[model samples]
Each structure stands twice: as structure tokens, then as C-alpha cells.
Target: MAEFRQAGGKIDITATKAIAYHEVVVIGNIIAVASHSAKIGEKTSAYTEGVYEIKKGNEEITQGAKVYLTTDGAITATAEGNTYAGIAWRNATANDVVADVKINA
Candidate 1:
């Protein structure tokens, strides 16, 4: 038998640490962004899909480049030892601090 669950775009998460709104969160290999600010141990919603502005590393990311999440929660073009985040929605130069990333597309 099969059952239906809620839509998969958003999920409820318990904050392991204080999380600011829009901050990137990594659960296992899944990467998401907090929907709102939440204190440690508080429950919050996170969007698993859609494009968001995420901080980037010092590397230039071309449009549609595969981006990964660093240990410190920034986006990078390097895939080694990092979690897959999303694709860059636009080109990001080395001096750019952030990039639009479309996740779970």
C-alpha cells in the first residue's frame, strides 16, 4: 500500500544550533535553507527547493555551474569533500560575495 505525505518542497527541522533566516542547512547530504530564524532546539521550516542567494567562495562560478556546500556553509565550484548544493543561476565573479543558486531543480 502507498500513502501520500505533505508536499516535499518544505520540511520541518529542529535546529541543532541557532540558525538565522535564509541560512544554509545541511542534513546528511540534503542541502536546504532555513525559512526563518530559529533558536537551538526550536522547530523551523526549511525550503528544499527554489532559488536563493547564498554566500560564495573566492572562485568565479559560471552560469549553470555545479555548486557545492563547504563545511562552513558557503557555495563553491569544488565538489571534493563538499556537499552538493545546487547550480548557479548566474555567473559569479571572484569578488562576488553571493550567487543565486537553484536547488533541487
Candidate 2:
């Protein structure tokens, strides 16, 4: 028989950079939200599947729209050359700095 691990909703990650709690982090092609603060090279838990408030770029995002992470790390509706983060859980105007995103959904 195979040994079962913990649930998949959360997982341990080694910080590539100093990460603050609730911060959005990109690991390879996967995007996850930091559940707690951690310094670079330290291991910390992060949410792989959850809705979280993430910083957004200058674009209006509608609910259920696919959200992507720009090179600068902010979430946006654009997908060209950017990393797919998740779906927007709510609408966000261009002027809004934050959007509710379903991370890794």
C-alpha cells in the first residue's frame, strides 16, 4: 500500500524570495498563496487552492474571468506571455488595485 500524505489544499514550499503572509507567489508554472511569512530559502506552508485577494494591474476584471500574473507579479486579465494564475472570483475595475482570485483553480 502507498503512504498517504496530508490534504492537497496546502503544501510546503521553499521561498524563492522573502514572502509575506497572504502574498501571491509563483512556483514554476503554478501559482500559490503564502499562508505565512517566510524568509528566502525557508520552508513555509502555502495554499494551492483557495480564493484570495490579490493585487491587480490596470485592467478591469469581471467575475469568472481568467486571471494571469504579469512579469511584475500583479494579476491581470491579459494572458499574453504571462503566467496563468487563476479565475477572478469577483469583478474589479481598472482603478481597483485588488481582485478576489481563486488561486490555482
Candidate 3:
């Protein structure tokens, strides 16, 4: 089984006997801002993908802004100037995959 842990919550994945890796992606307008954490074991890999629409908050994040992830996890963000438009993740294990993202309001 796989596990996912975030700063605000956690989830125990029950679908591991069939999948060795999982990737999730989201793209749209971001109305809210949030942060999260993720961890991947050594047997599975997980990835998260999405696009963020900057509606508020500080627009200092550039397209190459550093997006931090948990151990063995990675985050990629694509933004136009200070407006972030997309986000992605790459998990290189089967530990805990968790992250926080913005939603379109």
C-alpha cells in the first residue's frame, strides 16, 4: 500500500497492489493559495500536475520559482512573470505523497 501525508492532512492509499507509480495533474485558475508536503518511498513513484491562476497574494513567484517538495519528491511550477499558471510533481518512491495547491474561485 501507498501512503500520503500533508501538513494539513494525510491519506493512506489502498491502491498499491496494482500500481507501482501514480501521477496527478491539475490545471486552471487559482483563487486560493496553499502549501503541502510529500514523501515517496523506494518502491513507488508519485507525481502531481496542475496549473495555477494567480488571483491574489504576492505575485513575486517567477516562472522559475523554486517549489519545494518532501523527501524524494519534486514540484514544478510554470508561471508567466509573477503569475503562476501550472504545477506538477514527480515522486520517485512509494512513501507518502502530499502537497498543497490553489483552487479556482
Off by over 4 Å in 3: 1-47, 67-105
Model 1, position 11: C-alpha lDDT score: 86
Candidate 1: misplaced stretches above 4 Å?
none
- State which candidate, 2 or 3, has the greater lDDT: 2
Can you give the TM-score per candidate against the true fold? 0.92, 0.89, 0.18
Task: Find the 10 residues in a row with the least total lDDT in model 1.
Answer: 96-105
**Candidate 3 whole-model C-alpha lDDT, 0 to 1:** 0.30
| Per-residue lDDT over 46-89 for candidate 2, one digit per residue giving the tens place of the 0 to 100 score | 88898888888878999999999888879988899999999999
Q: Give candidate 2's error at residue 89 in angstroms.
A: 0.8
Q: Which predicted model would earn the best lDDT?
A: 1
The sequence of per-residue lDDT tens digits that candidate 1 reaches over residues 1-105 is: 979998899989999999999889998788998999999999999999999989888889999988999999899999999999989999999999998899855
What total of clashing residue pairs does each candidate reach? 0, 0, 14
- Identify the leading candidate in terms of TM-score: 1
Judge candidate 2 against the unseen true structure and give its global Cα lDDT, from 0 to 1: 0.89
State how far residue 11 of model 1 sits from its true place (Å): 0.9
Give the better candidate number (1 or 3) by lDDT.
1
State in Å the error of residue 34, model 1: 0.7
